[model samples]
Target: MSITPQAQISAQDKSYSAKALVSIALAWAFDAMDFSILTFVLVDIMKDYGVPLTLAAAVSSATTFARLGGGFLGGLIGDSWGRKAGLVISIIWFTIFEFLTGFSIGFTLLFLVRILYGIGMGAMYANGTPMLMEMMPAKWRGFASGLMQSGFSFGYIFAAIIYRVWYGDLGWHAMFYIACIPALVVAIYIWAQVPESSRWRKEKSASKSHSVPVSHLFKDGNTWNTIHAALISLIAFGVTYPINIFYATLLKQHGHFSPAIVANTIIILNVAGIIGNILGGYLSDIIGRRAVLIISAIGTLACSFVFQSISTDWERNLFTFLIGLFSIGGVWAAIPTYIAEHFKTTVRSTGQGTTYHFGAAVGGAIIPLIVSGIAPSVGGLAHAMTYSVAITSILVIVLAVLWRESKGSVLE
Candidate 1:
């Protein structure tokens, strides 16, 4: 029997898909490293710069706040030029700022540099996620989304490892300097290996007009989706930052854990998160995106109570793993696929970027500042986080219930 031309093309496509996933996932991992490195060293920065916890926490807030604009600009670039261009530009932009972060002589300088770095971090997600989703086959998109999102865990784990091994010897500045090198390599790899999204190209060719105004997202029937998606994103980021940004501080200040213990615990959390990411993604494919999201939210809420009440070291570790699995891992895995499917290809990047980062601004930026400010009066970081998580998790459940499922929906 002779081989079919269709089969040959299918084989070629699978090969390209594999390459794209690897390349994009690598970039995501490095991006994670850069963003998260600050969390690990935040306490140290406070002592070194003679700043209060609230001021130091503001550094992270500034970065996340800037992500809102970066995400919007990145989506516009992706929509207007090409996904690949937006991605490459974002990678380069972040890498440069991350490296420059090493040179900051004061807290103000560090805060400003990080805000710039945050923009690049936001742009990377805006461009890379849509590109990956468009390249994947419908049946596999859930798993692929899960796998891509897991790069965040991988990056967190890498940052943990770097902090553990190098921080004592070389200090935090070296950590920022080291993170930029491999990220640049990933950018070059993406530039050379990853092709532009075929769906974006097709949409561009088929449309009568070249330019789609940003107003289109809020016009017609899209207004509700645009609003709902951003709301969900806001809740997601709001719930997540309380746990993620402050976990180390909680363990160190409240629990009085050693540096080694803190790093190891974080590693455990991220490992569980990685597993949750894959599980959530796979389950979303099997059940539905909405269902998985609801499950994650409910699970996170239950676990937060358990995590907060626990006393023993062993119990703390166990619940930490659970929090990572349910909250950090599962909820995020389904987000990219769910949100990207909300808009047509012509406006998909813009919709995904703007809505997602808008959430980050309120949830990620403002929430942390609130947490830091209220910690002393509220009982400390742990209690403030518990209250925040409970409220946000409830909101997520409400939002997830309201959202229509997008699993297996064909992209335009």
Candidate 2:
């Protein structure tokens, strides 16, 4: 039987149940927790292994590379096995590795485990975003996307608080051990709760009747648009993630803030991000996605300069909160929903996952290498961030000019 458009949407509204959102949120929250758990504990890990800071950063880079690979593979798996099942398997895989991460003895072993964990993480985020996006009503897409993305902040805060409590004497191993708990719980929740993406399931059946799989997303007209979107995401993160990671260290080094104060500031940033994400999602739903992006890009660029210049903690906190708010609407929540708009349901997950994770790999891995490689000769972290943010801002303007609005337009 052919699926009516109304019936398809109605089915999605009912099937995407609160249980499903909760499952996706839990998985993503765990994903964020696992990610930040390591960041909080990285110093101890470095001290224990006697590795250089640059080398320690490589572990994160390796995981990012692994996640990219996982995202590509997860698209196929989501197409074949189903989004719900793919999510379950990915969470389980990541959980197992996280459990084992506590036992790792050296940088090599830790890097090896993280690379494996990245595969699962890559698939989870890739599949999770599209799954949640497709399952919701068009009107609520931005809201759902923002709420889902906010899980990262929730996880980061949870990890920070947990680390503070546990890391006092138990050290970094306890943090990794703690990481295993949430993923395990999410794996079970996803297996038992989340429903398969009805859209993907319908498309897969349609493709079987045709005997030819859908073409890869890169071959489409929106392909160029998708590329631009991916580049913007990469450039956005070139500042976002790295800034979150390095800012505390820089404050301690040059701003004369103590480590405790620096840690509190980092937590505040994550908390502010949670608020920003909700506002961004709500605004995109009320205004249009394009409007949200334009506003976000301008705000992020302005905030970057102000954030870099502030020396006092109160000034820094106020600016950081605004920066987090700008980021919430534009870069973080809008990108996945924007990518989802560019392709048909058949290729929606593929386009969204690939561009998002590839951007992540670039932002997480390449940008850091560029900054660090130049840091010795270029003076210091603050100056490097200033230059990077300036370049990224121009790229955002160029990308905005390249993209035509996709909101309220039908996807294939």
Q: Model 1: per-residue lDDT, tens digit, 345-401?
A: 988888889999999999988998888888789886778888888888899989888
* Candidate 1 TM-score versus the reference: 0.97
Q: What is the lDDT of residue 201 in candidate 1?
A: 91
* lDDT comparing candidate 2 with the true structure: 0.73
- Give per-residue CA lDDT, model 2, range 1-412, as digits (tens): 9999999967766765566677797788888788777766656667889986677777877887788888878766776677787788888888888888888998799999999999988888767877887777777777777778788877877887776677777877877887788778878867776778777777777675432233656575666866776786687667576665556556655676654666677677777778777777777888777677677767777877653565876778887777767663345766667777776666665566677778878887788667656766767777776667667766766676667666555545
User: What is the lDDT for 207 in model 1?
Assistant: 82
**TM-scores for all predictions:** 0.97, 0.90
Looking at candidate 1, the ten consecutive residues that score lowest on lDDT are: 304-313
